[model samples]
Target: MFENATKQLRETVEAALPELNTVVGWRAGYDPLHMTPVFIKNAGDLSKLEWSPFCVQNLSGYLVKDPAVRAQDPSKKIGICVKGCDSRSLVALIQEKFIERNQIHVFGIPCRGTVDWRRVMKLGPLTGIQSARVEESRLVVEDANGGHTFALEDVLARKCLRCAHPNPVIHDVLIGEPVTPRVAVENSYGEVERMEEQSLEDRLGFWKKELDKCLRCYACRNACPLCVCQDRCIAETREPRWLTQRVGTSEKFLFHFIHALHLAGRCTECGECERACPMEIPVTLIKEKLNKITLELMSYEAGMDPEAVPPLLTFNPGETGL
Candidate 1:
């Protein structure tokens, strides 16, 4: 299925290349075991294109900085391939006026689930695993020793279990037949609910324990597609010094709080931040709490549609019953 999907995506790029300045997709990384986002300027480079569960990074973040591409250019466009979550980032980018709809061609893939390599590495030394293949009901893992079969659901990322949009909401070309939509589950925000019931002191203590593990690595921020404010980040600014450079518990807490607040109504709960955290902090809990608040109070979900304005950006004259 992935081979056919990649072939179709390659053909689309080939057809559209004359008018497109570049085609952005995942290429096999130098490590051979990983994939990295690649911008293909030549048709021959399409041979390097590949897709699999490992292709999890959101590539839409690059569109915001592609200076060579012009929205009005009749002879040029940028092509991007996106999974369900990545497509939402594109939608949010359009909604925020970061990019225009017609400026790029989108190739959408209906993701089943992606593996968390970190979790897989924790299973063992992985002495023999040469490659991984996803069968209908199981993952066929190959190693130097032999082949082992594991249930796909067992190794699937936690975020994928609660994902509601397995199929891309927007696409110029969809690569495969849509899979049955997984029933929307409530588990994504479960941790937040548990925390909310705790006493204020208990909640504070719980986060203190978690935040103490943080090394101030900034991996979470770097991995997030929506955290585009690189220049004005509170962590780096010195004039106001919202957060000190020291790696103390207070500084870590402040950093996490500021990060979560910045993404209060904007986070799409992609789990990129949590996944990227070296400390394995459940950073999604903070985002999920904000997500629940945004949904309940403002009646909004971020990145679902390009036309819907973000809750924080609009004001209702009658909001205060004035």
Candidate 2:
């Protein structure tokens, strides 16, 4: 199904390359079960471009967080292929003025869902993956030994399973037919709602247990597209001396909370933080809780509209009920 879409994507990018400095997309990773970001500057490299469930990285991050992208000639627009969630991150960056809307040529691809490689590996325990593909709501993998099949739901990334926007909110060109979202907008925060059912003590205990495993590697912060304050991050800065080298639950709790608080009304819930965490922490959930609060109190969802301002970022004199 995605073969035709991939073909169209390459054709579109190739045609647009004359006016673009680079077109960022995905290519096969070290294994069949993974995909990595690829920068297509010339037509010859289009064959390496791919589109599949394994294309999990949010390419939007490169726009704001990558130095290479920053070094490009400002006059030449950068092209990008974005899934629904990834497009939201792009919108958030545009809303924050990290990159101008006119600076990008977007080839929006409607995503069905992306595979969670960790989930696939866990279920497979099956090794030496030679090839993998999705067909008829199932993931089929061929390894050295033989073939294995797993239900799509069993291997799909947690974020994709709950995706409320399968079609890009903004795009210069659409690559494929739009897909129906797995969940409705009103039901997007089901996970956050479930956690809210826990008592206060339980909630605190839950965070304590989860955060204790934190390595403080700052993977979550670095992976976030909106976290553009890398040079003066509180976690590492010694001038103000916020966090210490000590390994303790309280310190970890503080670090995680501060990280989440920084993105309160800005996170697009792209799931990069959680996916990047080596400890398998559900780091994005921290931001999700904040997102839910912003939605309920201010009736705003981040990154949905490029022109709209984030609720927390602006003030209204007549606003009430804080």
TM-score winner: 2
Model 1: colliding residue pairs: 128-143, 128-144
User: Across residues 201-248, which tens digit of lDDT does each residue of candidate 1 receive?
Assistant: 999998999999999888888788788786678788888878766778
TM per candidate: 0.91, 0.98
lDDT of each: 0.79, 0.91
Candidate 2 lDDT? 0.91
lDDT digits (tens) for residues 50-120 of candidate 2? 99888999999889878998799889999999999999999999998999999999999999999998999
Model 2 spans > 4 angstroms off: none
Task: Give the Å shift of residue 192 in candidate 1.
Answer: 2.6
Highest lDDT against the true fold, candidate: 2
